[model samples]
Target: MTFHVELDEPRCVASGQCAVVAPDVFDQRDDDGVAVILDESPADDLLDDVREAVAICPAAALRLVEG
Candidate 1:
């Protein structure tokens, strides 16, 4: 199964936790402080880390949509 991740910008405060947890998949646009997804489908090994990021995100800005 593949999951797509997206950021709700309004809810995002650009804390960079998601990027820290999954740099291969997430990044912060330095100027704007917005979460940028490098890949829609991250590696299987990264799934756990991404899920941890989702759980740890204080602003609830990240979401994992299974498709």
Candidate 2:
């Protein structure tokens, strides 16, 4: 199964937790530190880290959809 990452930019709080947990899949904007999706469809090996990022997001801005 492949997972797609969705980020609600309006809901982001710029906490930078997502980047800390999943650098390969998530990053922060240089100007505002908003969460940015580096990889919309991450590889299976990075799923665990992505899951952690979604769970740890304080603003609940990150979502994972299986397709």
Candidate 3:
């Protein structure tokens, strides 16, 4: 299965919690401090952290797309 993640800018608050949980899969733009999905399909072991990031998103901007 392939997993995907995305951040809707209007809902994003630039908390950077996703990066804290899974740096390899998430990053923030230096110019605007916006969340970016670096890698949607991270390793299975990192799935937990990705899910945690989704759960912890303050603005509820994070979304998961399953394939």
Candidate 4:
């Protein structure tokens, strides 16, 4: 199964947890620190880290969508 990541920018609080948990998949904006999706469709091996990032997002702005 493959998963795609989505970010709700308005809901993000710039906690930086997602980037910390999955640097290859998520990052923060240099200015406002908003979450950024580096790889929308992450590799299967990164599922765990992506899942962890989605779960720990302080603002609940991250989601995984099966495609």
Q: Which RMSD values do the candidates have, in order?
A: 1.2, 0.6, 1.3, 0.7
- Per-residue C-alpha lDDT of model 4 across residues 1-67, encoded as one tens digit per residue: 9789999999999999999999999999999999999999999999999999999998899999976
Give all TM-scores, in the order shown: 0.87, 0.96, 0.85, 0.96
Cα displacement (angstroms), candidate 1, residue 31, comes to: 0.7
Model 2 residue 49 lDDT?
95
Q: Which stretches of candidate 2 lie over 4 Å from their true place?
A: none
Q: Which candidate do you rate higher for TM-score, 1 or 4?
A: 4
Over 4 Å off in model 1, which ranges? Answer: none
lDDT of 1 by residue, 1-67 (tens): 7888888888988888998998898899979888888887887778988898888888999998876
Off by over 4 Å in 3: none
Q: Relative to the true structure, how large is the alpha-carbon lDDT of every model?
A: 0.86, 0.96, 0.86, 0.96
Residue 26 in candidate 2 has what lDDT? 94
What is the C-alpha lDDT profile of model 3 across 1-67, one tens digit per residue? Answer: 6787877878889999998998989999899888998886777777788889999999999987767
Q: Which ten residues in a row have the lowest lDDT in candidate 1?
A: 36-45
lDDT of 2 by residue, 13-65 (tens): 99999999999999999999999999999999999999999999999999999
Q: After superposition, how far is residue 36 of candidate 3 from its true place, in Å?
A: 0.6
